[model samples]
Target: MLTRILPPPGPARLLTVITMVMSLGQGLWMAINAVYAVTVVRLTPGELGISLGVAAAIVLLSSIPLGHLADRAGPRTVQMWSFLALGPLTAALLFVNGFWSYLIVSSVQAIAYRAGNNARKAMIAGLVPKADRVGVLAYVRAAQNVSVAIGACLAGLALAAGSVPGYRAAVLFTALTFLVTGALTAMEAPVPPVPASAGAAFAVLRDVPFLMFTALDGLLVTHALLLDVVLPLWVLQHTDAPRWMSAAILLVNTAFVVAFQVRAARGTGEPKAAAWASLQGAGCVSVACVVFALSDGASLVPACLLLVAGALVQALGEVRQAAGSWTIAFELAPDHAQGQYQGTYKMGGDIGKMFAPALFAWLVLGHGALGWIVLALAYTGLGAAMPVVVARGARMRSGVREVAAAGN
Candidate 1:
C-alpha cells in the first residue's frame, strides 16, 4: 500500500517532492491571503476579488502559449525558467499596497505559476508511461494535499498573532519554498524528443470534439467551488453547526483524497474508463448536495452529522473527478503535443473557477435549498453527458488516424 501510494523512485518521485513543497507554500499563503489583504494591503473584499479575478484571467490567457513554448523548447527548459522567474515574483507580493499593485504583482505571479504548472504536467507525462501516468499524478496530488494541510496548520500559528509581521513571515516562507522547488525541478533529466507533428501552436483549439469534452469536464470541476466557497458559506449562513465545522469539512476532504485518490485513478488509462469514473463522481456530488441541503434546518447534532456526511461524499467525488480528468487530459492529448493539450484541458477548470463564485452564490445562496437541487441536477446532467462526449471524441480521433494512415 505504501509503495503504491508513493511515487516510484525516478523523475516522478522527484516531481512529487517538488509538488509537495510548492503546495505547502501555496497553502500557507492562501490561508492568510484574505486577512493579509484586509489588514496590510488595506483592500476591501471587492477589490481583492477583482484583483484575483484579473490574475486568473491572465493565467487563462497565457496557459496555452506557455504550454506551446514548453512543447517547443522541452518541458524541462520551460520549467527551469518558470521556477527562476517565480522566486522573485512571489516575493513581490509583499509590496502590494493597493489594487493596481496587487493586480500587477498577482498577474505576474499567476502567469509564472501557470507556466510552471504546464511544464510540470508535460514533464510528468514525458516521465511516466501512459499506463502509470494517472496513478503517478494521483500520488503527486495526494502529496500536495498532505503538504497543504501541514502548511495550513503552520499558517494558523502565524495567524494566531494577527500582526503584519506574522503575515510577512508566512509570505517570506512561501517565497523561499518557490526557490527551493525551482532548484529541485532544475535537477530533472532532459525530456525526450516529441514528434514533429506536435509542434503546432493552437492546433488543439481546432479539435471540436476534444473542446466539447473540455467544456463538460470544466462543469464537473466546479465541485472545487463547493468546497472552497459554497460549503463554508452554507454552513455559516444556513446550518446550526459550529463554525469550526467548516475547517473540519476541509480536513475531511483532504484525508479522503490522501487515502483514496490512487484507488480512484485505477483503470482510467482509457477514455471509456475515465468517462465512467467521471459519471460516478458526478453522482457522488449530487448526493453530497442533497446531504448538504438537509443540514439546513436540522438541530446541531444532526446538522454536524449531515455536514460531515456531505463533505465525505463530496471528497469521494473530488477524487474521482480529478483522477478521471487527469486521465482524459493526458489520454486525449496528442503524444507529441502533451503540453499544449494539457494546457487547453486546464483552461476548462480555470474558466469554471472564473464564473463559479457568482454562479454558485446565485444558485445556492440566493434561492436557498432549491438551489442545491438545481446544482445536483446540473451535476447529474453533465456527468451523464461525459461518456457520450468521450465516445464522440474517440470516434473523431479514430477517423483522423484512419485518414492519416490512408494518406501515408
Candidate 2:
C-alpha cells in the first residue's frame, strides 16, 4: 500500500531522522525560551507578551528572504549555513540581559530557524515524488512529535536532577543537534536548482491555485492556534478545569495522530484527496469547536474526549491538505523555478502565522460566544471550499502536460 506511491522506506528513512532530530532540538529549545523569560528578562505577562510578539515578527520578516535563498543556492547550502551558525549564536542568548538585546538574539535565531525549516521542507518537495508527499510527510510529522516527547522527557529528568543549568545544557543539546543535522544535510547530493531574483518571490503568488491554497491555509490556522494559544487562556480564565488541561489536551491530540497518521495519509489522489480531507477535517474540527465553545461543567474526562475527537478530525484534514497542497504546488511549479515557487508558497504560510493569532483572539474577546461561532464557520467554510477548488484545479493545465504534448 505504501510503496505504490511513496519512495521506498530506505531513502525516506533519512528524512525522517533529520525531522526527528529537529523536533528534539525544538523541544529543548523551549527551555531556552523559558530560561530567558525567568532569569534575564523577568517579564510580566504584558511585557512577555510583547517579547513573543517580537519573536513572531522576526520569523515573518525572515521567511521570504531565506526562502528565496534556498531557491537560489539550493536548500542544502541554506540548511548548512543556517544551522551551523545557530549553536554559537544561541550562546549569545545566555549573555543578553535586556529587551533590545533579547530582540537581537531572538531575531537572529528566528532567521536561522525559519531558513533551516524552509530549506528542509523545500528539499522534501525536491526529493520525494508527488503522490508520496502526504504519507511521507505524515511520517515526518509523527517523527517530530515523537521526538518532542523524548526531548521534553529528557529535559524534565535533567531539570529534576540539576535545575537551571540543567536546562542550559538542554539548550546546548539543541544547538548540537542543529549542527549535526545541518552537516548531514550538506553531505547529501545536490537538489534540483531554483531560480531566484528578488522579484521572483512575489511573482509566483500571482497564480490562482497558489493564492487559494494560502487563503484556505490561513483560515485553518486560526482554529489550530486556538488549540495552542487561545485554549490555554480560556481554560485559565473561563473554565474551572485544572492547569494540566492545556497540556493534557495537547497530549491527547499528539497521541491520536501518532497512533493513526499512517492509516490516514493514504488517500484518493489529487482532486478527490483535497475535497475528502477538507470535509473530514472541517467536520471534525467544527464539532470540536462547538463542544469546546459551549463546553462547561466538566470533569477532565469529557474535555479530553471532545478535544481528542476534534484533534483526530483535524489530523485527517492535515493529511489531505498535505497531499493536496504538495501535489498542486509541485505540479504547478515552473520547471526551471521549483525553488522560487516553493519559497513563494511557504512564504504565504509564514504570512498566515504572522496574522492569525490576533485575528482569532480578536474574535474570542470581542464577540465571545459569537466569536467561536465565527471560528466554527471558518472551518466549515474551508471544508466547503476545498472540493470546489480541487475540482477547478483538476481542469486546469499544468506546465508538465504542455511540455510533454508539444514534443515535435
Candidate 3:
C-alpha cells in the first residue's frame, strides 16, 4: 500500500515528505495563530481580520505574475527563492507590535507563499505524468491532512502549557520548518525547460472557456466553507445536536479524506470524467445540505443521525471535488505554460475563499433553514453547468490546434 501510494524512492518521494513536513508546521502555527495574535501580538479581532484580508488580497493580485515568473525562470528556481524568503518573513511575525509591522510582514509572507505554491504545483506537473497527476496530488493531500492532524494535536499540547509562550514556540517551530522545507526542496531535480511558444505572460486570461470552467470550479470549491465555517455555525445555532458534533464533523471529514481521497481519484484521468465526478459529488453535497437542514426540527437522536449522515456525504463531495479539480486544472493547462495556467486556476479557489465565507454566513446563518436550501440549489446548478463548460473548453482547444495546423 505504501509503495503504491508513494512515488518511487527518489525526488518525488522526497518532495512528498517535504510537503508533509511543511503542512505539519502550517497546522501547528494555524492552531495557535489566533490565540497568539490576540494575547502576544495584542491584536484586536478586527485588526486580525483586516490584516488577513490584506494578505489574501496581496496573494490574489500577485499569484499570476509570480506564476509567469515561474514559467519564465523555471519552477524550481522560483520555489527555492520563495521558500527561502518565506522562512524569514514568517519569523518576522515575532516582532509585529502594531498594525503596520503586522500588515507589512503578513503581506510579504502571503506573496512569498503564493509564489511558492504556484511553483510547487507546477513542479508537480513537471514531476508526474498526466495519468498519475491526480493520484499523486491525492497522496500529497492525504499527507497534508495527516500531518496537520498531528500538528494540531502538538499545538494543543503547547497551548495547554500557557497561551503566550506556548504560542510563540509554535510560531518559531513553524518558521524553522519553513526553512528546512526550503532547503530540502532546493535539492530536488530541476524543472524541465518551457517551450518557446508558450504564449504571453497572462495568456491564460484570454481563454474564455477555460475561465468559465475555472469560475464554476471556484463555486464548487465552496464545499470547503460548508465544512469549515457553515456547518459549525449551523450546528451551533440551528440543530439540537450537541455542540461537540461540530468537532465530530471535522473529524469525520479528515478521516474520510485521508482514507478515500486516492481511491476517489482513480479513473478520473480525463477532464470529462473529472467533471462528471464533480457533478456526482455535488449531488452528494446537495443531499447533505438537505439532510443538514432537516436536522433543525428533529430531536436529539435523529438530529445526531442527520448531522452524521450529512457530514459523511459532505466528505464524499470534498474528496471528489478535490480530485476532479486537480485533474481538470492539470489536463487543461498547456505544458509549456503550466505555471501561469495553474496560477490562474488557483485564483478560482482564492476567489471562493474570499467570498464564500461571507456568502455562506449570510445564506446559512442569516437566512436560517431556507438558506441551506438555497445553497443546495446553487451547488446543484454549478455542478450541472460544469460539464457544459468543460466541453466548450475542449472545443476551443481543438479549434486552436486546428488553426495552428492550418497555418503550418
Which regions of candidate 1 are displaced past 4 Å? 1-5, 192-199, 403-408
lDDT of 3 by residue, 1-408 (tens): 454346566666877888887888888977887777778888899999999899888888887888888888899888888888878888898889987788898889888888888999999989877888888888888878888988899898998997676777788888888888889888888897576566876888898887888889888888878878888877778878788888898889888988888889988899899989889888888988888888876777898899999999999988897888888888777777888888988888899999999989998898887988998999999999988888788777777778978999
The sequence of per-residue lDDT tens digits that candidate 1 reaches over residues 240-328 is 88888998998999889998898888888888999999999999999999998888767899999999999999999989988888888
Give the clash count for each candidate: 0, 0, 0
lDDT of 2 by residue, 89-128 (tens): 7767666667777777777887788888878777877777
Candidate 1 lDDT for residue 253 = 93
Over 4 Å off, model 3:
1-5, 193-197, 402-408
Q: What lDDT score belongs to each candidate, Candidate 1 first?
A: 0.86, 0.67, 0.84
User: Candidate 1: which pairs clash?
Assistant: none
- Model 3 RMSD in Å is 1.8
Better by TM-score, candidate 2 or 1: 1
Judge candidate 2 at residue 70 and give its lDDT: 80
